[model samples]
Target: MSTTDYLTQGRRVLEIERAALATLEKNLDAQFSQACELMHYCQGRVVVTGMGKSGHIGGKIAATLASTGTPAFFVHPGEASHGDLGMITKQDVVLALSNSGETGEVVSIIPVLKRLNVPLIAMTGRPDSTLATLADVHVCVAVEEEACPLGLAPTASTTATLAMGDALAVSLLHARGFTADDFALSHPGGSLGKRLLLRVADIMHTGARIPMVPTGAITTDALLEMSRKGLGMTSIVDDNNKLLGIFTDGDLRRILDLRTDVHQTPIDQVMTAGCITATADMLAAEALQLMESRKINSLIVVDAQQQVIGAFNMHDILQSGVI
Candidate 1:
């Protein structure tokens, strides 16, 4: 085929699927809400089942539901008959997919699902077919035509099914009041999960690693602490370990600008007082935002008694993958 033909085919396929989803959106009815309601209150997991292309889409739908707060898993319709049916308990709900609503493997299991006393939700192009007629809730995902030139492929229908699945997952997600923190717990290894759940205490340098100087220390003493800890700044604390001020390389530049004697000048006289501070419990991502918005490179972590407990710089955030 010519290059223009490939381009035309791709655009036509996208337009067909787009139109299919638009139709599915506008045609949503009471059954969609009833399906979400049933899945929301299910005591056991949702068991999704289908055959052929529908089976592939069903697997993705199941995964999306599981990750978005609803407990779900995919079971091949053909396998449901050979002991896998045991996976679907009476307390569980069934989401079966069939474009024609009469795939033999899927249809054959409808009676068993009914006998198990479980709610059956059917996503089908044929609302009048056997599966839809047997289901407790029938979500119609019918499309006008397939994206295939021969009009026999599953393109538009599968896209519609996937879109409907997303709608169902998001609806259940909203109804459950699932938060990003809850999602982070489910996805601890993912980047978004790290950003949401990583706490300041997890990455902050503490104990001897925290660059700190005594309140009566000279500018040279503070500069030495900064260099020793390699955090580019030093927290000046009093006898009680309470934060007094902060001396950074920026303070050093100003010290030299005035030609002050670093060996004789007390850090309390030259350090910036009341610098931006963080608590050990703050989110690292939240800390990154505080640093960016305040135009500061480092932060001092303090305890309830206002004692300097930890400190970290922009490099710390990058190392922790919070930036």
Candidate 2:
């Protein structure tokens, strides 16, 4: 096909899928609410099962539900018949998916689910199908047409199914009062998890790790502390450890340009007074924003009494993998 034909075909597919999604939204009725209520009150995990393409979408839906505070996992319909069916208990809810609602492997397990007293939630394009009739709650994900030019591939139908699954997951998420911390608990290893859960206190240099110079110290003392701490900057504080100013490598370069004797000049003479500061309770991501917005490399952390308790630099956030 020509380039123009390819572009037209791609855009047409997207328009079909977008229209399908719009239809799904309009058709969302009480069934959607009932499905959410069932999953929300489920005493056990949501066991999602499907056949082929539906299976792929079901897996993603299960993962989303699991991460959003709903306990859920995907089980293959084929595997469920062999032994995974035993995984479902009376307390759990079974979410079955099939566009036509008549996949043999999925249909074969309906009776067993009934016997196990597990509630069944069916997502299907045809509400009159056998699976829909058998389900305790039927969520219609009907789409007008497939995005594929062949009209045979599961395109628009699958997109509608995924969108409906997301709606269900998010409803349950809000119903459970799920917080970012709760989400972070599920995604602790990812960069997104680090951004949401990491705090300044967790990654900031504290105690001996922090470099400090008293107000009366020479500029050379600040330079030594900066070199020893290797954070590119040092906090200048008072006798009570209240932050007074900061002397960075940038300050030294500027002072050197003026030909000031570092050994003779007091640290306060060259330090940037009333520098920006952060609290230990601040989020590392927020601190990163502050640093970026202010065009600074580091910040001094203070307590409620404004004493220098800790400090951090951009490198610390990078090393901690919060970015």
Candidate 3:
């Protein structure tokens, strides 16, 4: 096939899958709600099981459900029949996936699920198929056509199934009032976790590390402090350690344009006063937003009395992996 033909085929597949998701969205009804309630109220974990390509989709669905405040795990139906069925409990809910809803390995587990009194939720393309008919709640993921031109591959149907699974997981996430902080608790090792959980106090330079000058200090003193701390800016504070203003490299440029003497000028006279400040408890991500919105590169961490407690710059946020 030519390059254009390859592109055309790819577009056709995407179009088919997109239409499949649209159909799934439109067909959603009380059955979807019923399925959510079953999983939400389940005292035990959600046990997902399927065969072949359906199993791949089921594994992803289980992971999504688990990450979004729903306790879930995938159990291969073939394995379940061999012995993994012991993993399912009466308090648990089983989610089974199959395009035809008649995979023998998946169907064979129905009697055991029934015996354990575990609630079964089936996702399938056929409503009248065995798995669907036996399930306590059936979510129809029927699509008009397969994305594969041969109509032999589980393409659009699998995409529809995964979308439906996401719908259920997100619905449960909202129902449980899951917060970003709660998500960060589960994902605490990566950059995503740092962005969600890292606070200003955690990354801000404290004590002598903070570039600060007394209220009556000269512009030269502020410049020296900035150089020593390597933060590009210095906080101006009063005798009580309360923040008065800030002097940055930009402020020095403006003063230089006026031909002001850095040694003779008081920082307070040339500093940028009433600058934006952040609190120690603020999320680093929020601090980043404040910096970007105000078009500034540094933030002074202050107390309730406006005392300069800490400070950080854009580079600190980036290096801390909270960007």
- TM-score per prediction, in order, is 0.95, 0.96, 0.95
Q: Count backbone overlaps in model 3.
A: 0
Which stretches in model 3 have alpha-carbon errors above 4 Å? Answer: none
lDDT per residue (tens digit) for residues 201-299 in model 2:
998889998999999898888889999999999999899999888998888899999999998999988889989999988889999999999999988
| lDDT (C-alpha, whole model) for all candidates | 0.94, 0.94, 0.94
Error of 2 at 233 (Å): 1.5
RMSD of each: 1.5, 1.3, 1.6
- lDDT, candidate 1, 140-163, per-residue tens: 999999999898879999999999
Query: What pairs collide in candidate 3?
Result: none
Q: Least accurate stretch of 10 residues (summed lDDT) in model 2?
A: 143-152
What is candidate 3's TM-score against the reference? 0.95
Worst 10 residues of 3 by lDDT: 81-90
